[model samples]
Target: MLQPVPFPIRKECPPGACICERERLLDDPQGDTRILRLTSEEEKRLVARIDSISTYADLQHIEERMREQLGIDLRISPGMHEVRTVRGFNIQIVERPGLCRKTRQSIPAAIRRCLDKNPDIAYAILNAHDLLRDD
Candidate 1:
């Protein structure tokens, strides 16, 4: 008899929009994608970095560093939000269900380690939303 593989329990979120466990919509043969939510301090730092971008070169530098270090794709586009003029964006660190539960759970810690080692990647994610807003 073959033993059944155990899967990680999906985190439950309350009704309404919650960033705690956002699901990524894409072609994932593996399964649903999990997003890495930032902590309050991290969010503050990211907002500050986003506010500091004064030139296209600065944004480009952040993007390059993130790709090189985190191996994650950055995407920015015009989107509708609560405010008519505001744009929505997403910087996703995807972990598929096919991956070992341990590996999947370690994603956040791994990202934090990378951020601590080189913070520019976090800046890239924060600044991504600003790209469409500035234009």
Candidate 2:
């Protein structure tokens, strides 16, 4: 398989390894991480999706609203999630891919229901995205 990092390697990198981009440089005295560079099409898609969303329409509302408000278009619909604070009481909802999808409509509701029904949970919050996990 083609490696994400260039082959033939280099002396600077440790032998038998090709670290694409570490979150932190362990060997370097000053740690550094690369910033994301999104493609034009990807940016367009994101804007299109975001345009469609609204307050109560669920995360999908953002995407739909974006499309309506702007000429941009998107083929993919991102996801959303709800999370509980460290206290395990307060709730905050955020958008995340692992949390929602086109076919999966019950994630937010389920989270809200779980929070509302669970006396132990004081509140909950959503995971904004899985960007860190996504390659």
Candidate 3:
């Protein structure tokens, strides 16, 4: 994963957006992490699947499946747990803001590399996903 230092959260970040970006660096000063947005299909499926996840084991299973199928990791962020809802819980997935040069360049390369390797996947990572800002 191409991880970058945690840039401060922006005012625009939704009220309950994840703080994992902040905590990750504290846990491992040298750890590199990449934040990726879910594809529309992935997002839809996640909304449906989340309702079924009632336990840690269930969540792990879904996370693994997401990784295998979407090439993204699903982590439980602090914001996710803190959010309140009447019917269901809230989940936020945000990319680190103010990505450095290396991190910014890597995103396009990663997107292209995935496209080149898989002819079956037919979406433009650069265009299809909201990569830069959470808005």
TM-score per candidate, chains pooled: 0.32, 0.20, 0.29
C-alpha root-mean-square deviation, each candidate: 11.2, 16.6, 17.0
Compose the digit string of candidate 2's lDDT tens values, residues 28-120.
444221111222344445434433333333434543543454222323213333333333322233332111132123323343354354423
Using TM-score as the measure, the top candidate is: 1
Alpha-carbon lDDT of model 1: 0.40
Ranking by lDDT: 1, 3, 2
Q: Write the per-residue lDDT of candidate 1 for residues 1-135, one digit (tens) a residue.
A: 222224333343454534432333223434333222233344345445645555446655655654453333444333344322222322234443222333333333344444444445444544565633334
Q: Which stretches of candidate 1 lie over 4 Å from their true place?
A: 1-15, 19-37, 65-72, 77-135
lDDT of 3: 0.37
Task: Tell me the spans in candidate 2 whose CA falls farther than 4 Å from its real position.
Answer: 1-37, 60-135
How high is the lDDT of residue 135 in model 1? Answer: 43
